[model samples]
Target: MRRRPQKPRPTGASQYRINHQIRIPQIRVIGPEGDQLGIMSPDEARDIAVEAGLDLVEVAPTAKPPVCRIMDYGKFRYEQSKKVSSARSARVEIKTLRMRPKTDTHDMETITRKARSFLEKGDKVRFVMRLRGREQAHISLWITKLNAMVETLNDIATVIQTPRIEGRMITATIEPNNSSSQSSSSSSSSAPSTTTSSSSS
Candidate 1:
């Protein structure tokens, strides 16, 4: 009977070939504590890993001779998952709040509170105002409301884009005020004033 070809391994930062799954003939080995073990056949690498009670993992498969490391595979996988999670949480996102030209004071206040919360969390806020039918004719009303909203958030946010009408919507963008404040502080600190004293001969 003809032998079936092995399935290709999955490729990602989290994927790795361990122990018997490593099918290469020769590999460069790294010990459990990260010391180099020189070049060896797969069988020899596996033996060393077994003796040390760890896994032989193909860490750098694209090298001249594949590089394998001896470590606790379970712990390595757990750490990799944590790194991915940390990266995802660190990403900044743009959050949006919708309003209408006729939005009441109470409703606008509620929306503004939500927007402030988003800004405090280091996210950009996009304020969108929708107009319907005859409301589109009075775009200035929406612009006025947007400007007022920007003023309310001035303490924690800086206007990135002024209100502009787009189709039936008016949009404005704002970012965390700390960015502007930090830049201004840095600029002021870098340009210190100098005083010159004249001496009489």
Candidate 2:
């Protein structure tokens, strides 16, 4: 006979609404216009929301008495989308580069070139040095190599993670120098001075 597969457990957010034994608590209703309608029964709240051609969504379900709102679900979802988009637009991207401990000088130079490009593009880089065979016994060599790379890029990049061994690899991360922004701002400030001189004399 075949056995049935076990169902996966619900997440913390899902578990509450599923097994809640309390009464479908009455929700105080409020209109989208920010008007307070005071406390009302669930059925009455639903009726009021339907009359306004909107949804009766529970806003604060954990309050002593839950609160419901009469609002357009479509408009509410649009506002939420705007908030998430704005947050994502403010975040910077990160890039990664991988190398082995036995990597030669030419290859290291190529990798460093790529790392510099990433930093110039306002992206952070993760440098990974993978170890093999007896190389794992000489972890110090990996640290020394990473330090040299950091020194090469010190003017344009800042170390975010010091070299550390994890499993069979040593890893480090670096971000673009914050001074890049300051220098750009200073150059723009000088541009206005030049423009003012041209305008006056």
Number of the top lDDT candidate: 1
Report the lDDT tens digits of candidate 2 across residue range 84-189.
7755533555566778777788888888888898778666677877788999888997799888987899989988789998899888977789734544554444
Q: Per-residue CA lDDT of candidate 1, range 1-201, in tens?
A: 222222335657557888888887799999988899999998898888877777788899999899999887777877977987765544546777887788888888888888898889766788888888999888887798889988999999999799998888898988788755554554444442222211111
lDDT: worst 10-residue window of model 2: 192-201
In candidate 2, which residue ranges exceed 4 Å CA deviation?
1-89, 179-201
Clashing residue pairs for model 2 = none
Model 2 residue 25 distance off true place after TM-score fit, in angstroms: 42
**Model 1 stretches with alpha carbons more than 4 Å out:** 1-27, 31-36, 39-66, 70-86, 179-201
For candidate 1, the TM-score is: 0.56
TM-score on alpha carbons, each prediction: 0.56, 0.46
| lDDT for residue 108 in candidate 2, whole number 0-100 | 84
How many residue pairs collide in each prediction? Answer: 0, 0
User: What is each predicted model's overall lDDT from 0 to 1?
Assistant: 0.77, 0.67
Q: Which residue pairs in model 1 clash with each other?
A: none
